[model samples]
Structures are given as structure tokens and as C-alpha cells.
Target: MAAAPQPLAPDPAADLALRLALTIRHDGQGGVADDLVDPDGLTRWVHAHAAALPAGELPFTADDAALAAVRDLRAAVRALFARAVPGEPSRADARHLMPVEEALRRLNAAAAAVPVVPHLTWPPGDGPAAGHRAAAAGAPAAAALTAALAHAAIAFLAGPDRTRLRACHAPRCVRYFLKDHPRQEWCSPSCGNRARVARHHDRHRPGAGT
Candidate 1:
């Protein structure tokens, strides 16, 4: 049987962090139904989501640059998976790989900054009024962070298989993918064939003897 795509390591915290990056990347690549959303917009939405959650905080600012950084990180992450391996982070063009590694480190750090109660089970309606007041008090930082965390968790986990979470193999399809089948050899078979022909020509042409 063909080998299964390596399962993502099971660390909900890390998964959630990665999810934010995935969502951001998905939005950037227009994979979430091809809306062509800006990375910043996604970040704002994530931030808002985390804020709404009771156990998180919002950052001080959701400015263009901050969102841009988030976008850049998302691109870096997508690139990392696009050039993947049997297990995890695979090697690729250094030009692309370095940025992705850097982004992973930075993004992980950013995710760590927000404090989240991994899984909280509050008694139903026991003291919701107090919780709301507390959330309101923490809106700027704590509340926003909660929304961001929840967003990241949902984005990272609970999605399609890893195949849909791949990078285009075509020379020109450098962007991430979320639709092509996992067994697909190329973003487009025509492109795949073109690459094969190019490789064959390079290997067998004139002076290029085996």
C-alpha cells in the first residue's frame, strides 16, 4: 500500500498554534473557497475570535504591519509544508526554507505569549455574569488573546486531510494547496508532464549521456 502522509504530532497546544498559521496561509492563498482574503484580515478575525473566548486576551494592536507579519509567517509555513517529507518539516530551497523556519520559531513564540486554559469546563450558567464582567475588564489584552487562541486551534485542527494541506509540486505552482488530491503528482498533470519531459531532456539530450 502507498504510505500514509505522516500524521501531525499530537500536541493540541502546538496544533492550535499551527492551526492559526494554517488558517492565515489558507486565507492568503484563497484556499478557503477562494475569497482572496488578506492575511491581515484573517489575523484580525483570529484576534477577534480569541478575544471573545473567556480565557484569552487581545493584543494591543491589530495594525497593518502586525497583520503583515502574521501573513508573512503564514506564507513561510505554507512553503515549509509545500516542500515536505515523509515525517515532518522537509528540506527545500534555502531561499524559502530559511524564512519558514524563522517564521515557525517566531510564530510559536507569539502563540506562547497568549495564555490559554487548554480545556476549561465551566459549570453551566453558574456565574456567567461575573465571567462576562471579567472578560469585559480584560478585553484589550486577555479577551483578545482568548479569541486568537481559539481561532488558532480551530484553524490548525479540524480541517481536511494533509493532502489538501500541501504545496503545489509544479515548478510554477509554488503556492500552497487545499484542494488537489493527496495522490496528485502535480498541481496540474500537464505541468507534471512538462516537468517530466524537462527532466528527461536534461538527462538524455546530446552531451548529457547517462
Candidate 2:
């Protein structure tokens, strides 16, 4: 069995977007390494993010339509990030924007139908201040799950943290990542190594230095 990809960023919302973008891993040579193309794989992916979701917001199983919807949303997210260039206004071409708009529409409908209530809880120690929590208001599991994912995407794109969004610079890596530090680029150490090795080979390739 293939191991699940680990979160690469600190923020949960950004991490969620990155996770969806990487459901299908790419080989360093323009090929697929692992693919979560079936409904079972998608269900596992949904369950893995359960902690970030409100309780009972995810269904016990995923239907074919739900799986297809997730796949489409994943593609839209990847396209948005891939086309975004630094120091420019974030924009998506029509092909990508259509799906994004559709996702926003679905999210809006879900949120309107089943609102997430806000509540407060006390801190662990020493502080009397409380943190706010959002709980789903009894909606269908599939709708709730879709709302959660859509919320994450909106937060990542509309918030200031969107500046940190980046596509892994490693060759043939289709994965996206959030920069954790000023110098961070590759999504992981393995990708970093792969990029460095590729650079080394490029410099040594049959060059006549003429």
C-alpha cells in the first residue's frame, strides 16, 4: 500500500489545499508514481482529514459522483496554483476558473443549507481566554464535507497567506506546497535532493565550453 502524503505546512487550510493537489503523485521523469483514482482511495483521503472537520461531517463511504467532484476540484486547485506567478495578481484562465466557480457555488449552497455554529472553549492552562470553534449544524455528511473543503480553499486563496502558496520547483513534481521558511522551495527533502541531482547532471552534460 502507498503511504499517505504528509502535510507540508503549518496552517490547516493551506495544508488541505496542498493535500488535494497531491492526490496523484508524479515521478521525477514526467510519469505517475502513485494515483488515488478510485472511490476507495478518495474515501481514505477524506477520512484522513477528519480531524480538521466537524464531527460527523464526512460520510462512511464516498459515491461515484462525490469522488468525481473531488477530482474536479483538485484539478481546479492545482491549475490555480500552477498558473499563479509571484508578484502578480492571482488569476486563473477560463479552463481553471470554471471549476473554481462551480466549487464556490456548491460551497455557498452547502453553507447556506447547513450553517456551522460558532462556540468558545477555554484554553489549556493559565489563560482565561477561550478559542472559538465552528461546529456543523446537522447536515448531510457529503455536503458538510464539501463545505469544509470549500471553506479551506477560500481561506487559503482570499487570506494573506496565499502569498506563501508555491508549486514545488523540483523537476517533474506536480505537487504544490506552502513555504514554511524564507528559503524553502521544494515540497520535501526527497524533492530537494532530486532537484539538486538534476542540476548537477545538467552542468556536467556533454558541454564543449566553446
Candidate 3:
């Protein structure tokens, strides 16, 4: 079986929105890779991201419609992510990114596709933490999943975590990541190494920094 185009380590704090944006990632061979290639891929992805999505009593299986919906939403998300961070965005889809307004419209439309309500919980000493649950129990699985993904994106964009979002411009790397430390530049150690090597080459080329 053909594997995903790009397979890299998962972010330590894998926020759902971040995860969705990461569905398209660097192949480490100077090419962009996509994970959601078909219905099976979508089903796997959704099931794997259970913690980040709304809880369903029954397992949600993806169909062609679900796959298409999520993929389109991802395009909007990645475009918005590009706008969120500083400097150049991922090269793979930079040329074809939808307009900012269009992206917002799509996100909103997907989010509203399913009715949802806040599920809140307050522990002993902590404030209430809010979560989501589809208001309609019988809503289509596809709609619920896509809406959940869209809702996660909205939360991520509006939350403080968005401030730390960064674009990894390391050589052969194309991803958006949350900066864990003040000095973190690349998404992972491998990317950092690649970037360092690239920089060293740039500094010690035949021209010798002319």
C-alpha cells in the first residue's frame, strides 16, 4: 500500500486545529505531502483525532462527501494559518491559497453545518473548561465530524495559542507550528538541523559571504 506523502513526528501538544493544518506536511525530501488521500484515509484521520473532536456515541465512518468537505476546509485553514504567522508560508499551496474572506466564509459555513452546544466542566479549584457536543443527536456523522474540525479551528485561532503559531521555513520543510520555547524556529529537531546545514552552506559558498 502507498503510504502518506509526508510522514513526520506529531507535535507534542497536538491541538486539533494545528493537527488539521498539519494534514499537509513536508515529505523531508523537498516535497509537500498529503495525508487525506481518500475515504479510508479520512476515516483513519478522524478516528485518530478522537480526543480533539466531538464525542460520538457511535463510530463515525467517513464517506466521499466527508473527505471532500474536510479537505476543502483544510485549504481554508492553511491559508488562514499563512496569514496568521510572520514571513513566508508553506510553499506548496502558497500560489493557490484561497482569499482570506473566502477562507473565513468556508470555515464559518462548515462550523455551522452541525448544531453544537457547549459542554462545560469545572474541577475543584479550576475555572470552567468548555467543550462541544452536537446539539442534534441524530446528525450525520460526516457533518458532525467536519463541524467539530471547524469548531476546533475557530477555538485555536481565537485562543492565545494562536500568538505562538509559527511557520517552519527550514529547507525542505513546510509546516506551521506552535513555538514551544523562545528560541524554537523549526517545527522539529530534524528541521532545525536541515536549516542549520542550509545556513552553513549559504555562509561558506564559493563567494564566501562576499
Against the true structure, whose lDDT is highest? Answer: 3
Better of 1 and 2 by lDDT: 2
* Local accuracy of candidate 1 as per-residue lDDT tens digits, 64-103: 5555555555555555454442333312223455554564
Poorest stretch of ten by lDDT in candidate 3: 4-13
Please name the candidate that would achieve the greatest TM-score relative to the true structure: 3
lDDT of 2 by residue, 1-210 (tens): 986555444466767766776775666566655445877887888888777665565555887876776666665566555545354222212223445455556545544544555455456876563222335355555555665666666667777667777766676665666776777877789889988999898888897353
Residue 5's lDDT in candidate 3: 40
Count of residue pairs whose backbone atoms collide, per candidate:
19, 0, 0
TM-score of each: 0.43, 0.71, 0.85
lDDT of 3 by residue, 1-210 (tens): 985345333332248888888888888777878899899988888778776666682387778998999999999999899898878786656787999999999999998988788788889999997776888788787777778888878877877777788888887666898876677888898998988999999998898857
User: Which of the predicted structures, 2 or 3, would earn the higher TM-score when compared with the native?
Assistant: 3
Better of 1 and 3 by TM-score: 3
- The CA lDDT of each predicted structure is 0.45, 0.63, 0.81
**CA shift of 167, model 2, Å:** 0.8
Once all C-alphas are superposed, what RMSD does model 1 give against the true structure? Answer: 8.6
Worst 10 residues of 1 by lDDT: 27-36
Q: Rank order by TM-score, top first?
A: 3, 2, 1
